[model samples]
Target chain A: EAEVAQSPRYKITEKSQAVAFWCDPISGHATLYWYRQILGQGPELLVQFQDESVVDDSQLPKDRFSAERLKGVDSTLKIQPAELGDSAMYLCASSLPDSTGELFFGEGSRLTVL
Target chain B: AQSVTQLDSQVPVFEEAPVELRCNYSSSVSVYLFWYVQYPNQGLQLLLKYLSGSTLVKGINGFEAEFNKSQTSFHLRKPSVHISDTAEYFCAVSDPYQGGKLIFGQGTELSVKP
Candidate 1:
């Protein structure tokens, strides 16, 4: 029954502002992920972490977005100079190990940039 | 590379009616498939997954899916649905070689009318 935890269920900010979303994965999980869910579309991976090391981030917009799992447990995703198109639900998920193919997600933080 | 496709953008059904959500994928290597449900204002929840062995996998809330490797399809079906079942469903695929990075399809919204 352990669930991934996310903070600030809703966020609103102006363009060019900075915003951050936080997530705490289930205990013992080793892989963490950050995804963006635009309205009317499925979630897209922004970054992924294996423990404290970044595994994949090829799709991440590095110039504007950054994510880190400092302790290999909780993670934070930050976006600087937010754009209107950046408005979306930021979801965090975690799994026990790679290739499990089962993930537990947190109740995403919905961001709106004006 | 792996990609998923959800054929229906939306499916409307009355309460207690059976429903099926179509999902397909294209992959060059071995893959795993998963179905996730998202309630309004909430994060994604794993509905089911197909890793190996069984062609038919049963998941939470009485939902099931069959993995057709030949057809590259993994369709979700439920015997009966309720108003609470109204939400968005996403189909995703991951290549084993990619370390479980998921590629998702455009979601299918299931509107269970009362």
Candidate 2:
């Protein structure tokens, strides 16, 4: 099956360090999303992209986080000066534009900030 | 804007027993509802969705959900669960007004004991 791909499924870093996660969406998918899930909570959208262009990032903590999909197929999310509170699971998902609104997700990157 | 609420935080059930996970949503515009499952250290996977048509939607892993617009609820149910079914389940909402951005609930952990 065509699944969204994510890398570095697990990462541990100390505070004030930098961390990055990458995602490759399914082929032909036009919408891609990045979400964060606290240990006991559900996933929350951090950013969204439609064919290499950002569509929504209203909830992103912009001062510390930045995301981009330079080629419209794959994406990278970066966090500078990571804090302990940044420990969580980062999930990536992709879907077709104006479709049934179903999303296919990657295995996700689990980040732990010390 | 759309928001989802999973009333139960955790549900403990014995193997072969039926389970139900409750979810309620609030939205000003028309919306779509979804249920996703997350095994330990894994990304979220779609379980089922309710967009239109039949209110009862069946999904993978012997799971089903019923959408009740009057009650503003979409609850997930599994006739019988297995130990392998232990995981966190999330309920989400998406609407066109927000550019198809999905909002998720706090999640409900289903623990199936053998």
lDDT of 1 by residue, A10-47 (tens): 99999999999999999999999999999999999999
User: TM-score of each candidate?
Assistant: 0.97, 0.97
lDDT of the candidates, in the order given: 0.92, 0.92
RMSD of each: 1.1, 1.1
Find the 10 residues in a row with the least total lDDT in model 1 chain A.
A95-104
Q: Which parts of model 2 are misplaced by more than 4 Å? A: none
Best by DockQ: 1
With a 3 Å backbone cut-off (N, CA, C), the pairs that clash in candidate 1 are none
Distance from true position, residue B37, model 1, in Å?
0.6
Q: Tens digits of per-residue lDDT for model 1 on B2-113?
A: 7889999999999999999999999888898999999999988889999899999999999999999899999999999989899999999988777777889999999999
Residues B1-114, model 2: lDDT tens digits: 678899999999999999999999998888988998999888888899888899999999999999999999999999999999999999999885555677899999999999
